[model samples]
Target: MRPALFASLLLILVSAPMTADCPCIPLTHVWVVKTCNDWNCASTELAVANGDPQVIAVPVGMNDSRWLVVRRFTAGAAVDVNDDSFQLKQFDGMDGAVKHYSGMTRDYHPMLMTAPDGQVLVLSTKQPEPRGRAVAH
Candidate 1:
């Protein structure tokens, strides 16, 4: 191969951009998740342009790496909830817990309590599932 061609090829390889990283899940219309080491690393609150916590405590949950309902915080923030980037106030400095919390409609499944364990509690606003066919009285 020509020397110039070989050098050009080398330059192209060197100048290529690295793999685009996975995007962070936005917690509220505010915070987003950050990742490192091929795993969720931390939860960071997005400054309100002027630097202030979004100040909304949407409940967060922790699943056991299986996305199953392990526990749910009815009073936490999704601001870093969809991923493992939330801080557990009661878990004794246990950070880096993945939050699968999703489906929010005017802040009303859960209210005023935390699930037995922290798992992403999908907010269900609809009424309970029907039991059988309806009948007129």
Candidate 2:
């Protein structure tokens, strides 16, 4: 075999995307919280890796609350959220769609901003879509 041929083959193999045979795709964990009040009481945390997602939602009061949703996927997996993958969608408290935003992660942490009202949706596989929200492709 020629050295050039070997090098070309190696490059192709390296550039190829990782397959299921290799390992599970990376899992991203995002945490978003905001208070019903206007005070500085909002906080968010995000992390990404090869793991599972954990979503939790808790009601704060009779008319105010917060939701925590986890969206997971393979390292290179893409879900169709508002015609986009690896993105987040915000619904108007089970009503209309507010907006669509992409995930921004740096150093295994996502740089996502939290919202005050409505529900949050993250695109991932092996999970059911949120109620009253569009499903990812």
Candidate 3:
């Protein structure tokens, strides 16, 4: 092989792994619950450009409990809610534990709450599964 061609191929092979292993910058957004009802709560939406911590409320009671629901806001958004670069964290209070959610089964709607000790809990309604055709294993 030509010396120049061999050197070029060697350089490409050495740099390929580095580029693949490059870490991605984290994308974060905080939603502050302003009002609550039996079903869902209203939250303040902060722009994606703002990289500040929005005020989050601790669950007061069963009626005032809130869940951090994840979804894609835009069709062409760079990061999806289930992406590793995207992260969701819940805090009980200023000095409470922080819960991180990533790479979980995607549900149409999931009710999630963070305990005072940073445990992530899920709330689900007891409903019978809809009938569907079974697939052969």
Per-prediction TM-score to the true structure, in the order listed: 0.21, 0.20, 0.25
Candidate number that wins on TM-score, 1 or 3: 3
lDDT of 1 by residue, 1-137 (tens): 69999999988887664554557664522222222221222112222223332222332332233111122222344333455432222221123121322233333222222333432223322333335678989
TM-score, candidate number 3: 0.25
Model 3 has an lDDT value of 0.39
After TM-score superposition, the amount by which residue 113's alpha carbon in candidate 2 deviates from its true location, in angstroms, is 17
| Ranking 1 against 3 by lDDT, winner | 3
TM-score: model 2 vs. ground truth: 0.20
Q: lDDT rank, highest first?
A: 3, 2, 1
Put down candidate 2 lDDT per residue, 1-137, tens digits, no spaces: 69999999988898775542666555643333322231122223222222333323332322234333433333345533433222344443432332222332232222233333234543222223344558899
Please list the C-alpha lDDT of all candidates, in the order they appear. Answer: 0.32, 0.36, 0.39
What is candidate 1's TM-score against the reference? 0.21
Name the candidate, 2 or 3, with the larger lDDT value. Answer: 3
The weakest ten consecutive residues by lDDT in model 1 span 89-98
Instruction: Please provide, for model 3 over 1-137, each residue's C-alpha lDDT reduced to its tens digit, 9 standing for 90 to 100.
Output: 69999999999999998889557666543332232332234243223324333333333233335433333222244434342212344444533322222223333122466543343444332232245689999
Top-lDDT structure, candidate number = 3
State residue 81's C-alpha deviation in candidate 3, in Å. 23
